[model samples]
Target: MKTIAILVFTAFLMISCTSKSNKIIAQKDYDKYMEIKDNKSKDFAQNEINFWQAKYDKAPNQTSYLSQLASNYSKLFENTGDVKYLYKVEALLLQVNKEYKYTAVGPIRSLGRNYISQHRFREALVLANKALAIGEGMKETQKLLFDVNMELGNYAEAEKNLKYLTNKTDFDYLIRVSKWNDHLGDLKTAITFMEKAKEIAVINDNKSLKIWTFSNLGDLNGHDGNIQKSYDYYLKTLAIEPNNSYALKGIAWIAFSNEKDTKEATRIIDNISKRHHTPDFYLLKAQIAEYENNQALKSKNLSEYFNMLNTINYGAMYNKYNTLIYADDKNTAAKALEIAKIEIDHRPTPDSYDLLAWSYYNLGDSKKALEIEQKYVVGKSFEPKLNYHLATIYKANNMMAKVAPIKKELLKSTFELGPTLEKKITNL
Candidate 1:
C-alpha cells in the first residue's frame, strides 16, 4: 500500500507540474515576471557600469580603468543582446589599446571576445595571438587562443593549446573537449563530455553555466537525431532564462523541423526577432520561406539578411551560411566558390573542405568535388547536414553504391532536415 501510494503521488505531482507548465503565461505576465526577476541583474550591471565609468571619467588616461569600464560594458552587452553596448565596448577597448600601444593583455583579450561575439573570427584570432604574445604562459589567454584557432579551422593548433589547458574539473575545458570530439566525428563521446560539463555546472550552482550547457546539449542532441531529448533540453533552458535567444531559436527549430508546424515556427521566431536583432534570425526566416515554397518571401528575407550582414562587421562569420546560400541557389555558384576558397584559406578543416567540394559540385565540377570529398570530407564529421551534402555530391558524381548507405543514415535525421527536406531526402 505504501509503494502504491508513492507511485500515485508521483503521477499526481507529474500531472500537476505539466498542467502548470501548460498554462501559457500571457505576454503581460511574462513581462511582469521578467521585470521582477531580471531587473535586479540589469540594474546591478548598470550600477557596475556607472561605477567603472566614473572611475574612467576621473582618470581619463588610466588604461586599467578604461579596460574595467570596457569589461562592464561587455557584461551589459552579454546580459542584454544590444548592439549599442558592443559599439561602446569597441570604442573603449580601442582607446585602451591606443594608450597602451596594444600591450595590455586584458583589453586585448576583452576586445577579442567582443570580436568573437560579433562573429568577426579572423579579427578575434589576430587579437588572441597578440594577447598570447603579451601574456605568454597565461592559461586564460591560451584558452582564448584555443577557441579562436578552432574557429579558424586550425584543428591541430587548437588541440595543442587545449592539451595545455585541459582540466577534468574545469567547465570550459570539458566543453572544449566536447566540441573537439564533435568535430572529430565522435558524437557519443562528445555528448558524454558535454553531459559531464553540464553536471559540473549543476554542482557549481551556476545558473548561467547551466543555461549554456543545456542549450549546447540541446544542439548536440538535435545534431545526433535525438529530437525529443533536444526539445526537452531547450525547454529546460527556457524555464531558467525565458529570454535566452539561442534557446528560443532551438525551440523554433523543433517546431519547424520536428513538428512540421511552420506557423508555430514563424510565431516563435517573430517573437524572438522582436527582442533580438541577430542577422541569423532573418536567415532562418528565409529558410522557412523556402520550405513553404514562397519564393518572393525567400528572396526578400535573403536580401534583408544580407543587408543586416553588411551593417555588422562579421569577419569570416557567415562563410558557412553564405556557402549554402550561394551553392544551393546555383545562380551564385561562382560566389559560393569564392567564399569556399576563403574558408579553406582561413581554416582547412574538413567542414571547410566540404564547403569547397559542394561549391565545385554546384559549379558542375563533379569530378573535382568527388576527389575533394574522398580526400577530406568523408569520415571527418558526423554532422547530418554534412552527410546530406556529401550524399548529394556522390549522387551527382554517379557514385550509386555510395549513395544508399548515406541515404539510409540521413533518413534517420528526419527532424534535422525538416519535413520539406526530409521529403526530398526520401525521394533521394
Candidate 2:
C-alpha cells in the first residue's frame, strides 16, 4: 500500500511538471490585446501623410514635405503591414535623393533603410557607401553601413562599423550590439544589452523606441525559452501600439507552439490578417493546418499565399520564403535552386546559403548540400530553422555523429520551430 502511494505521488508530480511546462500562455493576459479596437495610431499616421502630401503638392520643391511624407508612410506600414505603403515610401525617398542629386546623406541613409526593408541589401550597401563618401551624418551613415554589412554577411566589415559606433549607453548602439551578440549565439548577453536599451527607452518615454524594445525583447525572450516573459513583453508592446501585428503574432506563436492551442492561435492570427493582410500570416496559418493534419486547409492557405505573392510583386522581399516553399516540392526543387542562387547573389548571408543548401538537398544532391553547409552554414548561423536543415543534411550524408548534438539542441527549440516541425525534429 505504501509502495502504491509512492508511485501515485511520483506520477502526480510528473503530470504536474508536464502541465506547468505546457501551460505558458494565459488568455486573460492577452485577451484584451486580441480585441479589435479603433486604430487611432494608424489614422494619425495617415492624416500626417495626407497633410505632408498636400503640402508637397502645394510646394513641389519643398523636400522637407517629401521627407515627412516618407516618414509617415513608413509609420503606416508599421501599423498596417501593407507592402504598398513601403513601396510608396521608397518612391518618395528615391525622388528626394534624386532631387538632391544623391549628395544628401540624410536622404541617402533613409533610402538605404527603405532598401533594407525590401531586402535589397546590396543596394542598401551602395547607398551606405555613398553616404559615407558624402562625409555628412557620418555617425548615422556608419550605423546604416553596419546594418547593411550585417545583412550581406560582411561580418568583418560589420564589426569594424560597430567598433566605430562604440557607445555602450546609446540606444541605437546598444540594440545593434545586442543583435551582434545574438548572431554569435550569446543570447544571454543579447538580452542584457537589449534590457539596457529598454531601460533607455523607458527613461526617455519615447513611444516608438518603447514599442521597438518591448517587441524585440519579446522575441529574444521567446528564443531563450522564457515564454511567460515573452508574452508579457508582447503585451507591453500592444499596450503602446494597439495595432502592433508583430506583438500579436508573438502571442499567437506562444499559443500555437508552446501551448499547442491551434484554435486560439488561429483566432488571433485570423484577427490580425483581417487588418494587416500580410503574406507571411498565410504561411503561418498553413503551418498550423499542417500541424493539425488538415491537408486541405494547408493547401488552401499555401495556395492563397502564393497567389498573393503573384498578385503583388514584392520584389526580393519574399525570396527566402519562396525558396523554402519551392524546395519542399519535388517538381519545384529546381525553381528553389534558381531562387536560392538569386538570394545568394543579393546577400550571401549564412541564412541565404542555408536556403541554397536546402535546395540542393531537396534535389537529392546531398553531397553538394553538405559542402555548402560545411563551408558557410555549419557555425556561421544559429537560427533554429538553419540548424534543422543542417542536421537533416548531416543525417543524409550519414554523418550521425554530427547530427546528434544538433538534434539535442533542436529538441529544446521546438517552440521556435513551431508545432509542424516538432515531430520532424523528434524523428531527426
Candidate 3:
C-alpha cells in the first residue's frame, strides 16, 4: 500500500517552531473531513499581530515577545504572499538578535529561517552554524544546517546531518526524512514518511500542519501518477485554507495535465494569480495558451510573467525560472548563461548545474554542456525533468547512443511525466 505522507512545512518555515490518527476513507469522505470553517473571516495574521503587539507593548525590550512577533510575520508572509511581512520579520529578528547579544537561539534560528525563505542559503548557513556553535537549538539548528547544505550542493554534509536528525519520530524528523528520500528519488519512501508525519499532525489537531501535509500529499500523489488522489488532497488543503495558492496551483495542473481541461486550468490559475500575485502562475497561463495555439494569449501571459519578475526584483529567488525562460529562447541565451553562472556560484547543486549546462546547450556549446552534465547532473539526479534535459543534451552533442537509457527510464513514469511530455518521450 502506498502510504500518504503528511504534508509538513515548506523549506521556508522549517525551523525552530514546530498530528494522530490513521483512518482511510473514500474520496468523498476525505473531502468532507477536510472541510473546516471558512478562513476568510479569520484574520489570523491580524489576530497574531494584536496579541504580539500587545505583548510587545507591555515589554518593548522583551526578546521573547519580539521573537514571537517575528514568527507571526513569517506566517503572515506565507499567508499573504506579500514581501512586506517578510521585511517586518527580518527587521524584528535583527532587532532581537542585537538586543539579545546573538545568544538568543530562538531568535537566531527564526532569523535564519527568514533568510532561507528568501533563498539566502549562505547567510542562513552562517546563522545556523552560529546557533550550533553556541549549543543552542542543536537539533533544529542541525536540521537547518542540513537544509542549507543541501541547497548549497554539499550533499555529503547534508546526509551526515540528516542522519543525526532522523533518530526521532517527531514531525520534524519525519518531514525531513520524507524530503531526504524525495531528493534521493525514492518517492515511495518519501510518501511513507510524509504519511506518518501527517497522521501525527492530524491527531494533534493542528490546522496549519494539516494544511501543509494535505497539500504535499496532493503533489506527491500527482507526481506518483495518482491523479484522483492528488486532486482529493488538494481539495482537502483548500477545505482547510480556502484561499491556498499552492493548493490552487496544484488543482490547476491536475485540470490541465490529467483532465485535459485547459479552460478549467486557466480559470483556476487566474484565481491563484489574482490572489497570490506569483509570476509562475502567469507562466502556467502561458503554457496553457501555447497548447491551444493562442499566440496572442501566450505572448500576453509571457509578458505579464516577465513584468512581474521585473517588478519583484527577486534576485536569486527567480534565478531558476529566469534561467529556464532564457534557455528556451535564443534572444535570451546570453542572459540565461549569466543567470546560470550566478546560480552555480550560489548553490552548485545538480539542479543548478543542469541549468548552467542547459544555458551552454542553448548557446550552441554542446561539448561544454555535456561536460557539465556528466560531472554534476547525469547520475546525480533522478528527477524525470532533469533526465529529459540530459537526454536532449546528449542528442544535441550527437551522442544518440547515450540517450536511449535515459529515455527508457523516463518512459517508465509516463503518467508522472504528463501527456504532452509523454508524447515527447515516446518520440525520443
Candidate 4:
C-alpha cells in the first residue's frame, strides 16, 4: 500500500508514467533505441522523446504525457552534448511551460537541468525552487533542487535537502546521497554510500544502477589518488557497459598517471576525442604529448588545452614535468620539487608521496622512491607488476637480501594463488 502510494505520488510528480497503448510504444522504442545506445549511445535516450511524443499524440489532452515528452527530449540534449538538440529542448521546455505550467513537474526540473548545463546556476536555482514550491510527490524535484543549490555553493541548503532525501532510505535515495558526498569532497563517505548503491543494484538486478555505482566508485578512487584502483573500477564498469565515454576518459587518465605510458594513453584519449571532443580528452592528449620529444604535437595539444580555461589539473602537470626536465638549470626542477612537496604537505596519502618520491627519483635520486614504495606496496604485492618492480629495485644497490621476502609475497599474492596455479606454486 505504501509502495502503491509512493509510485502514484511519483507519477503525480513526474506528471505521467504510461498507459497500455503508450507503454507498448515506449517499450518498442526502448528496444529499438537500446540497439543503438552503445556506451557512446545518445540516440536511444533521445528516441525516448519520440516514444513519449507518440503517447501524447494519441492523447493530446494528457498534459502530463507532453510534459514527460519534453523532459525526455531535454535529457537527450543533455546526454548527447548536441546544442541543436538542446535548442529543441529549449522549445520543448517552453512548450511545457506554456501548456501545463500550472502542474507540470517535468518542464520545471528539465529547465533547471538545462540551465545548469548552460552554467546558468542562478537561473537553474530559480526553476528548481519553483518546482519545489509546487506540490510534487517524488524526491527528484528535491534532488534537482539540492544539486542546483550545491552548484550555487549553497552547501547548507544542499545539505538540508540532501539529508531529507537520504533519509528516505530507498535505493534511489542511497545513490543520491552517494553523489552528494562525492561532490562535497567526502570521497570516503561517497564510497560508503555508493557501496550500498552497488549492493542495491545487485539485489534489484538493475544494470543502470550498477553502471552508475561502478563509475562513481571509479571517480572516488581517482579522488583518493588510487589511480590504478580508479582505472580498474572504470574497466569493470566498461566490461558491463562499453561506450561509457567517461570511463573511457578515466582509462586515459589512469594510464598517464599510473603507468605513464604515453603511447597507450594517447591512443585511448585520441580515439575518445574523435567521437566526444570533450575538453578533458584534449587536455589529456596535450599532457601525453608534453612528455614526448615531438614539438609539433606538443604545441598542438597545448593550444587545445589552453583554449579550455576551466580545466582541473591545468598547468599543474606541465609545471611539474618542466621542472623535472630542467631541475638544475634555473633550479626550476628544484622549484618544482618544492611545489610537489607543498602539495604533499596538504595531502600526504600514498599517491602524493608516490608522486613526490618519483619526482625526486627522476632528479637522479632513488632514495625517495625506496621510502615511498613501502607505503605503496601496501598489500598490493600479490599483483605481478609492482612487486616485480619493487623486487628488482630491491635487488639493485645490494638490497638482494630483501628478494626472498618479496618472492614469498609474490608467490602468496592473489594472481599467483589461483586454483590451477596452486599446484604449480606448491611445486616451486
Candidates sorted on lDDT, descending: 2, 3, 1, 4
- The alpha-carbon lDDT assigned to residue 380 of candidate 3 equals 88
For candidate 3, report its TM-score: 0.88
- Note the Cα lDDT for every prediction shown: 0.72, 0.83, 0.73, 0.54
Question: Could you say which candidate leads in TM-score?
Answer: 2
Number of the top lDDT candidate:
2
Tell me the tens digit of each residue's lDDT in model 4 across 1-428. 01101111011011101111111111221122223335434566667777888888998877677657655665454343334555566566777778875466767777777665554567777787788788685577777877666555466787887776746557767766775765554667877887887887878887766777776677666555454566567777766766555566555544444444667656666665554554445545554565555668866865665455344323232333333333333444456577667545432334344445555555656666667667654442223334544554455445777777766654543221222222333333
The true-versus-predicted C-alpha distance at residue 265 of model 2, in Å, is 0.4
Backbone clashes in each candidate structure, one number apiece? 0, 0, 13, 3
lDDT of 3 by residue, 76-133 (tens): 6676566667778989999999998999787888888777766788898899899999
Select the stronger candidate by TM-score from 2 and 3. 2
- TM-scores, all candidates, are 0.83, 0.94, 0.88, 0.58
What lDDT score is found at residue 284 in candidate 4? 51
Q: Give per-residue CA lDDT, model 2, range 1-428, as digits (tens).
A: 01101111111001100112557677787677666678988999989988888898899989989999989898787667777988999999999988989988988998888888888889889999999998987878878888888888999999999998857699888988998998898989999999999999999999988988887888788778777788789899989988877778887877777788999989998898888787888888888999999999999999999999899878998888889999999899999999999999999999999999999999999999999999999878878889999999999999999999998888888777776787998898
